[model samples]
Target: MADVKLDIRPVGAALGAEIRGVDLNHLRDDEFAAIEQAFADHLVVFFPEQDLTPDGHREFAARFGELEVINGLKKLDDQHPEIVVLDDAVTPAADVWHTDVTYRESPPITAILHMVECPPVGGDTMWINLYQAYETLSPPMKEMLEGCTAVHVNRYGAGNHEHPVVRVHPVTGRKSLYVNRIFASHIRQLSRPESRVLLEFLYRWCEQSRFSVRYRWSPGGVGMWDNRCTLHSVVNDWSGSRIIQRITVLGDKPTGLGEPRWPKFEPNANGASDFYDKNYPF
Candidate 1:
């Protein structure tokens, strides 16, 4: 395939770009480099109107890093475990804002999504830049947060995982607010009441419209985001059916600023139940 100069267009002031003139099915080494750079610069990139087979999707995701085969998801084919199918009829749309798989010790660094079908209107997705979320906080707030850790719990058997309240990006050396409304249960350093209050404030602060970008999906379009420094949620107002396939690239354990204010996290036999007692606001 001949090399075509990538036509990159910024979608929002905070964090998204749409790249035209490149085919995901056949990306050259240099073209892939440009795409990677765009991802790093913008935190999320979208490629519109490209036909990609399951194998091609997996191959493109693998170019970024090692692929993670996720369980408990509907698969496109039993032979292709790496690519999972998401049918809105079967799985309800995710209405809450969240980072992908933060309940794991090593969450995915990047998420690549391929749109198979979508509603004509109202099923857009939005992403927030956590880097901006962290940077905009007052100095005292940053000081208090630098040494904190938070526990994230999944209702499922995946159990609990603890991460820094403020995580430093492995590649960019940038700090980002890592807690979210969905999985993040509480701050490890504070009391239950204090954690709730603080988490609620951070949640509202991080999701301000100034730091987000909303994308409308189209069939055969592809969207990928840096999960390390962003939170995403889907708008649930659409009717009809929506279908997509996803592949994730494995990431390293998150590192935070300075030392943790508390000891390492270890769950007892009671599991996440301890965190889900009557006091849990949700």
Candidate 2:
């Protein structure tokens, strides 16, 4: 295995580790274990210089968990209908910094994105390490988020869906800061104005520069990241087209999906929750 030399390296502060040994085209079980361990230590892994068809990418990602069916995206291939194909030629949504489809009650566990087409210059993907993002916060801020929950959504304004601010990972059982700029409208169960004040403050910190890492892409490159604990953005400055085939592993409901402070609301309830309505004044 040492002869294979899994040239592991960190790409971004968001905890991306690049792997240079195993080929996804023909992965062995033990080699796969090495990659998974690298993922545990690094949270993200990229395999470069291996040629993969859409089937190859899906096959590799399925080894991790059940494949996710993207609600409104085209399938990569008939045989592998669960894959999501993301390319640079997409609409503006693809460029946004998001933890893929957090609008759902239960989001995906991880995501594997393979860069098939890359730009000549200027086009990189950025990710933020939520685990580190939470650890580095001031004690007061940490306290505020610990007992609080924020709504995440894709509907319009914030979180797009309602969920807690600090959630325990189902796989690792470790708590991570869950809010992101893509959604995270505000903290429900609090007065509208107070919620806004706190939510904005938290969002700013989560978006801080120190928590992120950027990865420049090349063809035949694959990056698999823990979606539950990281937020990623594909830079869209290139004039030319860049295409990437992405696969997601669906996850379960967040550990603290519906707490008294973080009540669950209808999928598209304009930010009002049952707990807030029945208990809070504003």
Overall lDDT per candidate, in order of appearance: 0.88, 0.73
Candidate 2 wrong stretches, greater than 4 Å = 1-5, 156-161, 256-282
Residues forming the 10-long window of minimal summed lDDT in candidate 1: 264-273
Q: Can you write out model 1's per-residue Cα lDDT over 200-244, one digit (the tens) per residue?
A: 999999999999999998988999999999999999999988899
Give TM-scores for every candidate, taking all chains together and pairing residue i with residue i.
0.91, 0.83
Candidate 1 lDDT (Cα, 0 to 1): 0.88
| Candidate 1 TM-score over all chains jointly | 0.91
**Candidate 2: tens digits of C-alpha lDDT, residues 1-282:** 323346788876557888886778788887887787788778777888888877778789888888877666767778777766776566453565667667778788888887878888868888877888788888987776776766666665323456778877776666778877766666765555577677677667766778888888888788878888888877767778777777888787776534554453342366654553443322
Deviation in angstroms for 52 in model 1? 1.2
Top model by TM-score, which number? 1
Residue 167: error of model 1 in Å?
A: 0.6
